[model samples]
Target: MVVQNATENSIKIMKNLKLKIRKTILIVFVSFFSIFSTYAQFDGVFSHYMHNLSLVNPSYAGENNMIQASLFQRTQWIGMPGAPIMSVLSVDTPFKLLERQHGVGVQFLSDIFGVFNNQQVKLLYAYKYKLGKGHFSFATNIGMINVICNADSINISKLTTDDGYHSDNDPAIPIGKQTGVGFDLGFGLNYVSDTYSLGASLTHVNSPIISIGDKNEFNVLPLMQVNGAYRFPLDRDNGKYKINTNVLFLTDFAVWTSHLSSILEINEKYWAGVGYRYQDSFSIQFGLELFDGFRLGYNFDIPSNRLILNTFGSHEVFATYEFSLVRQKSNSTKSIRIL
Candidate 1:
């Protein structure tokens, strides 16, 4: 495909660009890690790669030409007290009406962080347009997010005895739980051809205002995820080998930023790969594509730097299923999922 060829050529250019941008990366990393350790924050990563249909790019919803459902679970820094537990369930499908291709998606997500919890329900809508024999799609998602904080997790003894709020019966901290509501908006663009695809997205547009406790003063930062991926087939047809690579950069308004991760995947019934996360993390992922286009994937993040000293590795699992309603000759995307 022309897109594939162009990207291959562009990689050489990008490699150079990466080097030239060293100062930005270094500054971002230093600013990020320094603030990461000092925060009592919500867990990120509830939406993993597969469930990322809309999270990755709004236009990516239903890119595979079928109604799809995906779910993901991630437990970060296992064995560590107060580790994060998160999950996301997503469904998306494509349809044609009046000669227009449209996609819709809905997601339910929940994340728990120490004493804090967040639940969100989102709706996504996308439209597809043809561009020089390829399909270009753009989409937007808007929904509501609810946050809950459990005061029971706080230790009264841990606080300094002060008349300001040291009393366990103090009204500011809220002895039980508190709740708040907010809204979110996200948008994405995707370009998909016969052999390759690329996408970009921006999430958390409204910057939800959630004040969990009476005394807590800080607000949560609106997060961002910028990612792109490419696939290279070794041959034009009947290819036994192919490489899928991707890069993801995540940042918050605060100093916490994850040094983007690079992922490489090999396609087959059973595949294995590894990823290196620059923010002191590493991951190895494996997957199996079973019958009826069902897929199961897993990844383990190896602790690095200071994190390794406090906890065991992190683990994640993903599952997805997609099938055609009618027995029509399927396209490349459908074929790959079936395998």
Candidate 2:
């Protein structure tokens, strides 16, 4: 017995070492790729992506067969000047016309990063096809984005000589607010089944060019996203408690990032979860349901990178409400399959 235990321990140590080595290699490779291939400017990042699925993927609109409205807000890098702040509002509904399932939605987003701000309005359309017990959905998006830059607000006097902030007298710097407008397009596909959901989307498919200040043009590249989630019930009888495992992968024609999380929900009322963003941060999430259809959620992020030195953390909040206008023939026996 003593000999067998020693052999098992050795094997465990070897496995752990191999895992660590693989993780280290992966991090190095991703960092290298990010430094070399990245070109598109950073977009607004969100923590509660699971709750705001339709914001990223149009196909998720009206997937629950109900009228739904949601709101999301995020403040990144607490206590840091010129950090990113963003908010979005969206509403979607399903309608059947001529024996076909169709959905329509609208979204408005306001994002501010440093002296740059972008406001966008989008209209979404989706068609759903039923296949056995599941559904396949295709969606398209049409939108316009207004980009504004406040060049005059930049303060250069506070900068140190070593910090390289000496653009105060530059002739190219616009003296006032510079604005530009661009058209945006996107497409998405989503599949939903009894136990799992999967989706993929591409945004800014045309690489819209927005000229901010004079002679300065920015290209908004296509952003790719792939996400999946699976539900596991603790008890088969009532399903009062269940676990949801989710993963989201994203690329902006530059670098890649991912978020992985596991959440526990009880009686469809309360939920808690923990998640890790690849080479980014760890997050704690909490949520509650109220009054049948209203939901509130919050998330806190603890950065693992160099930003942790003087920053406290990031915060995000979201709310959603869902309601059905008319009852279906099998409403009593149907289950909620929304993301």
Candidate 3:
């Protein structure tokens, strides 16, 4: 009889503990939703922001003076369910017309998180003019943004009823896959020289709105970004070693984030760096030039926020290639009069 009473008490205690845990989890979820709903969704975060300048700043198109192509992929919050995954592809080239320099490019992006997926395609153009020892560029991009919500993938059976929530009975919740498309626009200004660069941009200038269904809609808000970088020779005699430092800032007026990084380059062929994103994560990067005009890079991020408790980290990889399309003059003759 005593053993039976003890067993009953033990079971009651376990049940009470589980109930408390569920309540705690529910509170955390509610708090997270309340905070998230106040902010607008922005572009996917990239650890290799230096190489992805063209994605955020249209003025970065063709800054390399060669036809360039790049590809990137990132997976965030490893071990965390429904974390973000992103991919990007872009190409740009420079041209001279009417004695003026111009640039043109195209970019494609895909981002997925939770039950939502987003795809984007943009056409970029830039006009450049000499400013001091550098060139100043004004640029713009127009694009289509498509968003998809996979409501059908949600498991209603797994949802707990302890909170008195019912997915099937909720009118506000979507029951099937929903998709929406909207127009996006952006503008940027940049200044670039051999040793340094600076840029600022605004994306989603139109604040586009898209309706997924009669019950759901999405509104994209404007985001502002600024970045700068400087490079100097560490081995001045041979100029084979150098240090590059970069900073990037992003804001949607209500929220802001920043990143600072420095890289050591050897023989212009190898690089390693470390970076910190404010209140977010710390990253390590390494890269090598695989061949002439071709390079590859990788980055690993260690979270510093609450996400660290749930995830191991994030991973990113990228590749870039650059080559000139213009033909070079092989030989030149000088007249004696000119000499």
Candidate 4:
């Protein structure tokens, strides 16, 4: 009789455990959906955007007319549970085809937020031409995104309960993983010259539907961005000392954000800057030309908003490498005595 009573008690505890797990799952999903549904769609944010412009603007691909590659990683809201972490890889090169200058690129990215995950791949193409004393570019991108939710990550065995029965396969709880895939499209335009650059882009123009569950579908909304940068010579020391001012504006129709920053370059090797995001955060930036063709950059963001109370801050680090084709060609020609 004691053995049977113990068995009954165990069953009761198991049932209560299952009940609490179900309730927790419900609350988590409700909170996530409630936060996301009010916005156009969830998009990753970056602090080192200038170094990774191709992530936001397709027209930026091959803008420097060189074979260039960049990698970026960002950790947002450190010390906050379920904060976002993202990474991106992008490469592009200038090419001549059909007697026209063009740019081609490929990009891959992975993002994780709490229990949600997103992976994406994109192909970018840009047409280049001359306008006035500057150059103009128009670009388009095609991509696919896979969205997922992993409910198995939750801890269920730790719960305690006194109920008499337990259903481990509760239908109300998402016990496994759910995923959906969708197509994405983007457009961008850029104009650049010796002194300045300007760009505008629109992403997710199609509003693709990502169906995580049979009954749950999210329509990715369009995001718009406009950016501009100007370079001013501070002193005429072989163009060593100069200040670059940049502004970026982003909007997803419902919410908007802006970044205004400036960098002082020294001897074409070192740079440092500071920035402010309206009602969002303050940022510090630093970069180095590590070698002839390699560069490294870092940005630290401190929350000036309410989020500071719950989290420490955010960090972004990126690196870039460029193939100096112009110098390579010049050397090749000179080596053969053709020049």
Best by TM-score: 3
Q: Tens-digit lDDT track for model 1 on 237-326?
A: 865666656566666655444433333444555666666666657888777778667888888888767999988889999888886686
The 10-residue segment of model 4 with minimum total lDDT is 330-339
Candidate 1: give the clashing pairs: none
Q: How well is each residue in 36-119 modelled by candidate 2, as lDDT tens digits?
A: 123334456577877757877899887777888999999988998666689999999888988989888999998876666778
CA-lDDT, candidates in order: 0.65, 0.78, 0.79, 0.78
lDDT of 3: 0.79
lDDT per residue for candidate 4 within 173-289, as digits (tens), equals: 345687889999999998887788889999999988887766667788898999888887798767778788888898888788888888887866788989898898999989897
lDDT comparing candidate 1 with the true structure: 0.65
Runs of candidate 4 with Cα error greater than 4 angstroms are 1-26, 36-42, 155-173, 324-327, 330-339
Instruction: Give me candidate 1's TM-score against the actual structure.
Output: 0.77
Q: Enumerate residue pairs that collide in model 4.
A: 12-163
- Residue ranges of candidate 2 with Cα displaced over 4 Å: 1-40, 155-169, 327-338
Model 4 TM-score, all chains together? 0.84
